[model samples]
Target chain A: MKIFVCVKPVPDTAAKIKVGGGASIDPAGVKFVLGPYDSRAASKAIALRDAAGDGSEVVAVAAGNPNKGESEARKRIKDVLALGADRGILIPDESYENRDPLAVAKALAAAIKNEGEFDLVFTGRQAVDDQAFSVGPMLATLLGVPCVTDVVGLEVDGKTATVKRAAEGRVEVLSVNLPCVITAQRDLAEEQYPKLKEILKANKKKIDTFSFEWPAPAYRVTELSPPPEPAAGKIVGEGPDAVPELVRLLREEAKALSF
Target chain B: MSEFRGVDFFLLDELLTDEELAMREAVRTFVDREFIDNRAIEEHHRAGTFPRDLPQKLGELGVLGPTLPDEYGCLGASSVAYGLMMQELERGDSGLRSFASVQGSLCMYPIYTFGSEEQKRHYLPKMARGELVACFGLTEPDHGSDPGGMETKAVRDGDGWVLNGSKMWITNGGIADIAIVWAKTEEDIRGFIVPTDAPGFSAPSIEGKFSLRASVTSELILQDVRVGPEALLPHSGGLKSPLMCLTQARYGIVWGVIGSMMAVFDEALRYTGSRTQFDRPLSSFQLVQRKLVMMHSELTKAQLIALRLGRLKDEGKMKHYHVSFGKRNNCKAAREVAKLGRELLGANGVCDEYQVMRHLMNIESVYTYEGTNEIHTLALGAHLTGHAAFRG
Candidate 1:
């Protein structure tokens, strides 16, 4: 089966992203890691095929340049391979510096659809950096397939899939047919621990690449600004009296109080 | 960034390629789901039981002995990837990572690096699959700092050898299926792989340990334990052989220490913000801010050093002294950071429920084990002075 995993490389969500003096995302000191949600998607795809009893080749395809030190993308690729994915397709994008999210998603969709056929597609619900939450749905629209967002459970049987999604404090079940895309969230499945054996196998797996025409821009970023840092607030009173004072501040100052 | 210049940090872009990340991601997902959240870890830590099914869980994840080369069921990810895996595991629990380190770095490494091909074939794959738990023994009660004074001796007994020695502080010792023990012959130090079921072999649990209590540390006594010539590690000679394994394990420590420090640092940072003090959150104080920044900078420096060393290790340019420097320096820095982190937590810090004191206790063992900080300093001094300092 040809399984495709589409992932985006973003600066580690936990990193202190510095907006430069020019208000641009600073590339100098930032470290990139695989989008955590996308990693869950890739992990699930690999697990699904493996449970089908081996001999399945899982391909993780991502768009990124390996030279600019966003090294997170390649590292993510290595992570997938180390977890038992058969191969990785790294499509380098020279235009990623200022690429728009929707445009980037469109380019990935076109490139993947053009190169080969896929039985199913997997993606994270959202990339942590931009939190655009647009790519997976957009890609599914491009492919003319149904997508279930925030999938916590998935089981594929021939041409149909049974999926579970948690919403409003309840588990919602949905059934979709073959070739559907899944946008996985963090709570989906537990990530596997890498053993020494698989880590070694990842080094030997074949990584093949092909360059294709990157689709022209379908969206553009007009501006970027840092979110305002939360201001430090003072604590009033001490010990037991502090609780009532905190409640007073929450009610009167921050206005987040319930009663 | 300047702190790490000229040091090859694991440049994921040009180095790891795409395939490696896929593999590592799989492992990370499994750990996060199965082990990190496993309440059983705390249960076992409390009950003093070996993580009974941890080997199976590891086998399911396919990560035990992960970087040992692909033919042996290893992932063969670059040293950097392996280091990251250690970081992730240590974040869950230091004991869990210790399980893998003893099995991989201390046990499997000696066999792979120094054993005969037959020995590797006989043990590597099973060990990799987590079918067998292996332990390494080098430290003895009387001679941790000076392994040269080790009293354990192996004597030739016709077609086989009779070994007599006692090894202590051995990780996975009591339950290990196989043990890679370092002992001395009349001429030099050597390594041997002895099956735990071998006659005259006994591994007794070392109880009442204040550190690494979650992980099993055992005492191994060999009374006329016999092994065929093939059991001997053919490549081992002098003190460098066992020390080489220490070199590998300590590099893992450089990363593992950071994982612990991050936990404490992150916790302390979060606590101060929520904690109330004089007319403000404890974090509002200038002194607290200073403590936080100091902890953060120390952790960051240690992280960069570990990452850079990981790259050098991948490039095969890592020197013994450089590794020692990272281990000694990072371990010392982490110990200091743990102390400050606990102090910043005030009354809640020392309690295990809050966990900073646990880190502080663990750092003491990390500082002394693998080779004490003083030992590393002496090793570094030897390089600087163009002289060996073991005797001096």
Candidate 2:
């Protein structure tokens, strides 16, 4: 089986993100890591390939420019390969900062198609940076393949794939045939930390790069700002007296209960 | 912003290869997931029996003697990479690092360095895989700093040797599958690979330690323990042989102390920020700022020194005095940093929940072992003054 894992490298969530004067975030001095969900997606692809035994190949695809030294894009592709991916394919695009979500998806779709036909394609539910959550579904739509999002568990038997996804207070299971796209959630798989030997091997694995013209973007980013701090909660009364207020607040302010 | 856990003050990470950084990250992640939140580690430290499964887990990571050849199930990486692994392991706990150090630097190293090809083929692969845990027995009951005076003797038998003596403060002792036993022979000091199950070879666990409680420290008793001629390390000779092993372990300790210091300082930074004093964060206080500054400076300096030492070791230019300088300086700095960190947390610091107290206690052992600070000072003193201070 031929598998493809789409990965993204984002600024480490734990690092201090400095918003620039132009409303763009400073990339300098910021540590980059594989997007949390993307790591799960890559891990899932590697797991599937391993379970399928010999002759199976897992390829990692990402959008990046080779001209930009130490760019997040190239690193993301390498990161997936380090996690046991057999090959890495990078779509060389320099306008990553200005490209909208749809344009990014188009480039990724082109890269996947350039790799010939893959039995399965995996992507993260969403990149941690920007939280766009659009690329996976958009790519699936472009490829004309069945797409499943928020997949926490997956099982494959021959050409049939069964996926368990998280819903609002419930789990929904879906079964699809061959040539499907899976957008992995956080719990899809426990990402494997590659040892030294694997890392060195991955470093030596040459990443094949492809160039493609960017399609007109469907959307544009306006302004980015940090989320507002939550308001401090108020306490009223004590003991039994507080219970009535709590119930009233839940019903009135929170709109959490009725009648 | 969340407190940054990756504290690379001098961009020392830039000095590392991609493989080295990746290896460190793997160990760092494993440690954070397994030991950082583990209440049982503290419990075991209190109870005196460390978890037996930890070495197996480390073995699965192929961290045991990772700098050794990959043909023996090791990583076949550079010495700097091995030092980084030790640093991360010690960041979790000193005992864990000690366990790896003894197994890798002390036991596996001598076999690979001095053993016959058959012995290396027999022990290195299994020991590297953690299938067969081993300990080094050089420090006898009376000889620690002066191992040359060790009384453990190996008398020539008809076709084997009869070993009679004891080793004290042996790490991984009671549970070790084999021991790299160094004994005085008719010619000179030689090492023997003694199986723990051999007749009259008993390793009893030592109890009630104020420091390094999580380690399986033991007293090894070899009463007429006998082994075949093949058990002997063919190439090893004199006290310098075991001292070479100590130099290797010390190289690791120099890096390991940085991890311990980093853990302490990271916790101290978090504690000072969140903890309030006089209606303001304790970090706002001038006195607290001074303490944090001191710790930050010391930790950064130690990190740079260890980085240079690791580079020197990988280049094969590392000398005994170099290890001494790094080990003695970093261990002492760690002691001071842990104490400051403990005080910064106030009453909460003494508790295991904070881990400063644990680091504080662990640093005491690190300061004494791998050559005490005073001994290192004298060694350096002799190097400079051209006068041996041992007699004085």
TM-score of predicted structure 2, chain A: 0.89
* Candidate 2 ranges beyond 4 A from true positions: A234-259, B1-4, B38-40
By TM-score, the best candidate is 2
What lDDT, from 0 to 1, does candidate 2 have?
0.87
> How far does residue B257 in candidate 1 sit from its true spot (Å)?
2.8
Q: Model 1: how far is A18 from its true place, Å?
A: 8.2
Cα lDDT for residue A22, candidate 2: 58
Show the lowest summed lDDT stretch of 10 residues, model 2 chain B.
B1-10
Mark the 10 consecutive residues where model 1 chain B has the least summed lDDT.
Answer: B1-10
Candidate 2, position B285, lDDT = 94
